[model samples]
Target: MEDMSRLDNACHRPLRSAAALGLVAVLTAGCTGTDADTTTAAVGRAAVETSPLPTVPPAQPASQLTRAEVETAVSRLDGVVRDAMRRTGVPGVAVGVVHDDKVLYLKGFGVRTAGTKDRIGVDTVFQLASVSKPLASTVVAAAVGEKTVAWDDPVIKHSAGFTLKDPWVTRHVTLADLFSHRSGLPDHAGDLLEDLGYDRSYILDHLRYQPLAPFRAHYAYTNFGLTEAAVAVARAAGTSWEKLSAEKLYRPLGMDSTSSSFADYDKAADKASLHVKTGNTWRAEHVRDADAQSPAGGASSTVRDMTKWLRLQLGNGTFEGRKLIDADALEQTHLPHIVSEPPHAPAGRAGFYGLGWNVSYDDQGRLKLGHSGAFALGAATNVTLLPSEKLGIVVLTNGEPIGVPEAIATTFLDTAQTGGPTVDWLTFLGPIIKQAAEGERSPVDYSKPPASPAPAKATSVYTGTYANDYFGPMTVSAKGGELTMQLGPKKQRFLLRHYDGDTFSYRTTGENAVGLSGVTFTVGSGGRADKVRVESLDTTGLGTFRRNG
Candidate 1:
């Protein structure tokens, strides 16, 4: 099955995290000093000097804190953010914090675009990516609040034409099943189609062809699965998902700068352009249009607008002295629905998925809800809420995930609780992000062809139209001694270069694009190639297209 676990490494927006308080092995003792008195007689002389008192570290924020003590951590966010920017070179960051129904902090650091004078601000919009999941849940909660859609309602009751591979599973799956990502869809079931330029409707409808797990018993993170639930809720509300968000969530909260439409983000006068680090310089070299999975990962908003949503979450569906949505429906989004992270050790605590958020409980039994959004193309964001203390913080960045946003949040949160960050968060997060990014590449180096490769036959043997129900029809054509492979709704062309006998290589391009991948053709006794294997698309053993003739 080509190691389905590779999806975890390539996954830019991982739904679960291994960095929770109880899971990460934090080694706190690093000062490397011994305050021992070796000379007993010298004790009388300046009290044995005591090795200069071993450089007593600053007091850590308590392991737990009451509402009044959170200020210690919230106050240092400016310097914390500046240090993070200086250290990580993430280009731009916008942070907002809400406490006690008040805006505690609103600030930005670094330029909106690298190598430019345009500075980011609280109102400079940035793509939310998977963080949009939690916000979409808020919109759905409003639908639930108004009785337009129930959390447990079957999806087919609202959105038509949605089905899974199993008809019984299709008939029984609920919005909660999809929202919590327990619908048995393979990990990132339809994202490849999106990368190939397919729209949301095509991807959603075609999900029935992918293989399934044991229904709600398995936990596989699927963006389109969660998106399907949002589409259904919008259908039940008799509105589009974009308008449903505007009417039920954004407009009501006065989040004028927030939008589910990519056009709004594309044309924003003040927006942080997505960036990636290139040879020690941050470059705004990529454009990401997530309209296909709008509800799952496409929303964009400024910190000023995000703070309002934070206030709503901390206020139990209320905003500025008004009840906006039902607290019951909204709070349910924070309840644990599935086991997202099982402990590695018996003493560790398991993390849970609650609607769109990563749900966990602290040592104090306080509820902590958070979500991270990332696009390998560029854009990292995080939103965390401590509802027990009515405190929440959101961090947005316009760069590929390097643990910058998550590190900043973890530092602030650590300071708020324990007087200071107990661990170097970037030290842990940087390696994980780097590993995931590298893991998305082809295991076999197609760039380096096999030595003494077998020569290919005439190009005529490979030119034909091959069909697969999953990948649709793929046509390979050759002109003037060059071969091109075309597929997808647009029939996007991939120039094929000879790699070996019956094998050609093409550079993969898209969200899931790993690199140069093999396209091997199998010739039959009759002479014409019968099928072609596209390695990049065959993660689940489904990339082979058979001859239709």
Candidate 2:
């Protein structure tokens, strides 16, 4: 089996903080005085007065952009973005930049797919991924503003079926805790359930089986927690999360092209095709339908639409002369709720998780809020907001595992503030991007032969039906001198090859089935394998299945 631990680590590591800016300042003064004291005293005074120690001045606030400056910045941004696409091999990208109440730049570049004539435009829809979190949180904020729900209300009050592994946490988890990712569930705890054809309700009910971190003790990014919160918001509002977001946020902010449904994406005339680089070329890839986890990361939108959303954020919940939500309630979503350990961070700046956004400080010591989203191999999206400067930028790319979005956002931020690029973003991000690309290219290695030549007993002894409560069923049988396993309702079958002692490996033949993986079967009485464990993409831990009949 491929090492799934590395894949999990690569896909879901906590986002790094912004890079630190280098600034230096010095202060010096000279004083000459006739001293009647001894020579030692005079020497001490001179030493203290003339020493040239480096001092750092308080960070200067970012300046607003003028019309002419905005034009120049956009022109420069166009070149930088195109350069990023070329260097990263991203098929297409759409960028939006909002400064205060105006959108200074909204445009797209390159073709929507590799080896295609379809041109990308500002209105082309792309999956927003985790960037959808803030939008969903905004809907919940609206519910709070209207007194339909309270942030502190126990989740069980709204969703009667809600439960967690711990009885105390199940009873005590709050709406705010859900949005803050502090519900105690491990990171991506129920992701495999979702991948195994389980519905949202089914996944929520099975949360009690998953392990938990101490409540609010540490940060564990979970999509199910947010999905639970969205369910509660929808229940309180007497509408689905999709409808609530549309009526409350999308329409109010004039984001007409945004949607929370995959159906809408299919019907849209202008949409970006999802792509993934294979070796040296970009190829089309299937976009995973996120309807089951809509609230967590399932929104699709255009740059033009997102520019309007940015304006509302900069306006503090108001947009186009309308106050869509109470300022206080909306601000609550932006307030830091828990500190996060970012792998990379600016000097003297710490990172935190707000209601739905990752909050950090810029080099200028100003609040910077943003989120990045990766749709497996499909795409990568990034949204950055500098509240103090009233600046926001959104970048969506069709081909990923690339750092193009982050590099572009950082470059835009630096350019907008200083009117020129001060960082070598591409060079700095090259190694990281290369590492991610290599991971994608080589998901599994099957070249090396297994240490053991055969199973403990005859292959026929392993043939039987195995079942898991959450994943449904798997039947093992010998066919043509090889062991084969069939999974779930689809009955997707993969030919198993003996890897070692009691271990076997299988390469998934169906797209929806688990990827190249391995399984270990434990022999019981009479040399029959009674228990089987799987190591695949859907699970980080070994999932055990017991022989049934």
Candidate 3:
């Protein structure tokens, strides 16, 4: 197995933060001199500074209000959202907050469609996009709760026609592998629109001829695998995936405004329009109907509906008068089965992975279980549950510029904390980072190397700035018989050596033992490095970087 832990140096971890109460003291200490003379002189002094000292009021007593108080403060948070929508080019957003089994706040802002005068409301339906994963995953959990499907059931057992490029790995792949995103396949393969073409069955049909990864590894999010998992859950439940979600999750949770389509969503009367930002303003774009990829990104819902779903999770999978689902199942969904370290996460540490949710810690190091999604030029969404505080947040936007979902979710939850409510995800999971090393297996990539090399003449076609709204800036410079890559200040002075026809590797200058564990660079026409791919240690996963020069 390739050791992904080696690539740990490629990314930086989030900064350590001080607790809210500790922040003031830390800042004060930093400002005050630490010299022995200063300490000696102040030995008999009062805690406060000398007389004419500015009367900085004592920190306001921590509010002891109820959840309703927190909700009310959050409800009046309209002004706090302008910047979030502005940065993401989203014209409107629907926000919801839930504490345990109750909906604390549900509201909307801006217009549903930018060109139109229609407004977004609490009941306005918008594309849930990848938020569908949780719902689809919930059904699978329900099936497990009822013994209809085993979490470890192999894909071939559920659907005999399935096959990958490698026959051996195909038969052995389990349903959990797909949902957990370790199934060798990447997010969307060659010309996804051409294969699936807005049709679900076609995607399943093409799965038979698709390639597989030799070794299942850590998380690399994939829509195809999750969709397959959704189908398997449907087959196990003896019903269609759509029907299963409606009956088991939607109806029981009273998510009347949620569905897999704009048509079905309209039944609720009040719904949000899908908007795409166009230079400074938003315009109504087609609602994403990637129903073919429904398991990955296809539900339409509102803040209220999502809040209700949050309550169910908070209530241990039961809602109102019905034990709609099992609490243990919900626990299973949040419990980390695989140790994964996603970007922006602390280095040399592995976070847990549930069925569809990527489990991690909030700024305070509290466990946070949630799933975030984005649709190209459509919308971005985030739903998070902090079980310890029995609090959750649902943030939906009609536009996305990457990272908006995570930012919004964090901001809202942090804001909620200021008002009497206290919810955290980590406190419930007992030292997740220190858990056992299970060495979970992910999908294996078996694609063969390219046939022949391109003509050998180089140009400066690689010199320019390529930006991914999420990953940050990548700069490539070539000079003095060498090419170098600078990914946000971290410079790589290395020789670009060719491997396969389109692939190349890097050898750091004057550095023998400190070589990059694994890296593949692809030069396009004109012998220009147009793509840079860092292979995961397992070689089954990928973090692809396209040439933007």
Candidate 4:
């Protein structure tokens, strides 16, 4: 969802095309709940130069199209999923398909919870928000094929309180540099401390106080910097990233209703529920738990356990006849390590990320790969693979992600690669997912304040508490005439309001919410204040706080 090809907006502001339309638009957001554009501290900054991705040659072995052209693009995908659910009223959708290797397609559409007669089943259970990053990179490529952890190791050699505001990029960051968001760690770093509730060991122990952008040469899409590299490759595989993703890849590929565990997608029994729209309908509003970034945006499955993991990722690691993950460690989670959307001109189309996969390559060279789990508080899942035509598709949806499952996997892989659907792709991607979700918001409207506003002081000159070694304590108080604030470790609150001299505002609420913001303060010497700031927890300026005594 956030590849905007570098025009800059989703997945932290680069939308020349929104990573060619997959899952994005969540936080800074796009994949893993649409992410980055803003952590892992000490702030070196200025990095995003980008480069690689020119390679092409070798896509010829002859399997691009057949089996009656993939059963005539699966008989026009139930009329393109009933005309994209009669045009974006997305109550529910589930789809799965795999080719050459089998499982042709499973389906489901609408009504998991809209007005309700309950339906939606290709075995229901939805929440794969941020498409749980390539299903937690196939459970860290089956713990690097049981050698126990090695995609370039180093997440402080297995999370000894992992750091990053630098210290040599915290002993050289790895697990493929935060699963290819490249450890420059900004753009969704520690995601607004998990939208203020905070956990995942207090957002990976405060991404060493947010800031960093020049290590493996910056890109951004971070979901707790890939959940601190999948909780340090599940602490070097001893276990518990939901039991190493049910013992190395969903119980050896039976995928048993998948699950990196948000309490097993809140006790499944055919799940769905996420919804959001509001006025024209879709209701079930936000319940996104995401088990502290459960390996980056909590996992959940079904499209019949994601087409048995798309037949074990086009069977490179083999699924049904045995092997279970280690086709040279899942071919290094499909190559292309970084540059996720850079080439804005000359040679044009570029984009990639691999090892948690978004990657690209097409114009006949083939490769492709993708990711797009979303949840601006609902869910919008997606997947597309080509692997030189073993072909693939997944599209789950509950509600709130406007581009309805990336226009049904781009009109079912452009009608299985060119027989139809070149456009009207959900009316050409619903205004590029409503202009990359209004370019990740926060342009500062604060509902419109500043017209002779200024009179605040003596709410005990802004009450007490404050601290903040990365959003730790906050307090404020006030009561009757009203002020509030509180904060993380479940203090929550946040009423504020005022908006002028000592500045104030609030309205924000969850999933990396970017709405009202600003809090300011700064007073000092007996006026009783000494630093406050907060503007949506200051993206790397580190959001002030101070006081304490």
Provide the overall lDDT of each model, using Cα atoms, as 2-decimal numbers.
0.76, 0.67, 0.53, 0.71
Candidate 2: list runs displaced more than 4 Å: 1-71, 342-348, 433-446, 508-515, 537-542
Poorest lDDT segment (10 consecutive residues) of candidate 2: 22-31
lDDT, candidate 2, 10-75, per-residue tens: 333221111101000000000000000013223323423422111332353665445565566667
lDDT of candidate 1 over 215-253, digit per residue (tens): 655667788998999999998988899999999999999
Give the per-residue lDDT of model 4 (tens digit) for 1-549: 323323223455312122334222111122211121124333323232233222333443456677776778788998898888887688889898888788888989878887878899898888876778778888888888888877777778788878877786787677877877778777766667777888888778888877777777667777777778887888777667888888888887777888877887888777988887866777887788878888766888889888888888888888878888888777777777767666556755556677777755555555667776666666777787776678788888887667777777766776666667655667756666656643355667878987888787877888889898887888898989888889888788989988787888887776556668788898987797777888777877887888898
Error in Å for residue 447 of model 3: 30
TM-score of 1: 0.89
Tell me the TM-score of each prediction against the true structure.
Answer: 0.89, 0.84, 0.62, 0.37
Q: Tell me, what's the RMSD of every candidate?
A: 13.0, 11.9, 17.2, 19.0
| Deviation in Å, model 4, residue 22 alpha carbon | 10
User: For candidate 3, lDDT tens digit of each residue in 186-205?
Assistant: 43321132221325665565
Worst ten in a row by lDDT for model 3: 12-21
lDDT for model 2, on a 0 to 1 scale?
0.67
